[model samples]
Target: MMMMMQQLQESPVQKNSLFNAMDRFIGAVNNMDQTVMVPSLLRDVPLDEDTEMSSLKSGSDDEESDMYSYYQLLKSIRVDIEWGVRRAAADERLQQQESHKTLSRRGSSASTSSYASSSMSLSEEEDSEDEDLQKQFQYHLTGLQGVLSKLTVQADSLTKRYKKEVGIGA
Candidate 1:
């Protein structure tokens, strides 16, 4: 009974074995065993160790030297995750823009078709009603765009802060 309740409250990440793996990877990176950590890095982060080692080493390969490649690898993964988040936000924005364009086109075609057929059967009162409905839809679409724009701004700001914390520039 206690185990069932604990399972229910566990986070998705906590429930998955991947989270355990990530914790272990972080431990290995902090431990400074580049050989052990490098394999894990290649499997997960896929960085070029030669370049990363050069950056961290500043030019010596002394076994007990202060320099370690794992910190750079950890930092690189954090940067990559931050950039991935920004890319996902940008992709969402692009999708919203396309949807807005498609809706605008749809509304315009509907108005044009309605106007063209106005002479046949739709009464003046019905025309006014349709116009009101169209206005309401346009207003809703404008509100949606405003919300998305605000969200995008917030996402950008969050990403900037994350980069700054990770010692990376926007």
Candidate 2:
């Protein structure tokens, strides 16, 4: 059991800062008294509206000041995570496309026996390889898509729940 736990501990996914920050954010949001705090939080500064840094950093209004500070921290961390995920996804897609192109080219141009024998076997191999690569890509893509979608849904649900709890809804 200890060895299993240690192995899980050592997994790269467990060490991801994005995951850690999100976990902490969710925990903080969950623990907050949404009815009391969130309405004021949402009204003072909405998620749709961008808070100016200068006003936030130097504002004298107590409510605006506190809300702006929290907003800044939350927004900054979220933006960072969003940028990282987008960049990582783009890089992965580019690599996959390049590998696919290379595979196609190699299969097409590789020297073998006669045209019929060579082409038939090569096509079969290419088809199988392509299918395998596609399956692998789909697996990773599905996992990533699921994680991102779940995060978005959770954030949105939390926001709506907070609004409802605080009687912020019209």
Candidate 3:
């Protein structure tokens, strides 16, 4: 047992495998497709109902689990926001570089009017794309904010409930 535990501790892959198994179990539970099989598998085993009741009564573990999930969602949203910002910045830089190159070429060429018109059109197209990107970012930001607010409310309520259950004044 000690050797197994030590090996598991030393192997990140083992930890990932364990988490993958847990994820699949949770997914199966959520889907309810394995409900019959689960009951049959556990038919000979006795479950600790008192422990479940005590855990539910305390509610701290549930709250922490919920908070962790919300934190992960928040992290994912932040990552998306960062990616969008970086992409927008890169697009802007690319457009500026393209415009500069066009300007330099126009100065040495005889097609000034044509180059100017093309540059204007390119700028307009880029601006439109930028606006679209901004709108998308705004939509995601608003949705994320709404979700974050809801999560905050839930966490606050959970904290209050846990406090009351433990006979602590909030």
Best by lDDT: 2
- Backbone clashes per model, in order? 0, 0, 0
Among all candidates shown, the one with the greatest TM-score: 3
Candidate 2's C-alpha runs over 4 A off are 1-81, 85-130
- Candidate 2 contains a number of clashing pairs equal to 0
- In model 3, the worst 10-residue window by lDDT is 44-53
Q: Write one digit per residue (lDDT tens) for candidate 2, span 37-143.
A: 63444444433232332333353455544443453444444565555546777799999999999997787667644467653577787899899999999887667
Candidate 2 has an lDDT of 0.55
Model 1 steric clash total: 0
TM-score of each: 0.28, 0.30, 0.31
Show model 3 residue runs off by greater than 4 Å.
1-120
Residue 65, candidate 1: Cα error in Å is 43
Which 10 consecutive positions of candidate 1 have the poorest summed lDDT?
Answer: 40-49
What's model 1's lDDT at 101? 90
lDDT by residue (tens digit), candidate 3, 1-170: 99999887878765334344334333432333222222233222221232322332243444333323333333344454444546777799999999998987778575555645565687787899799999999887666555444433433443343344345565
Instruction: Rank the models by TM-score, top first.
Output: 3, 2, 1
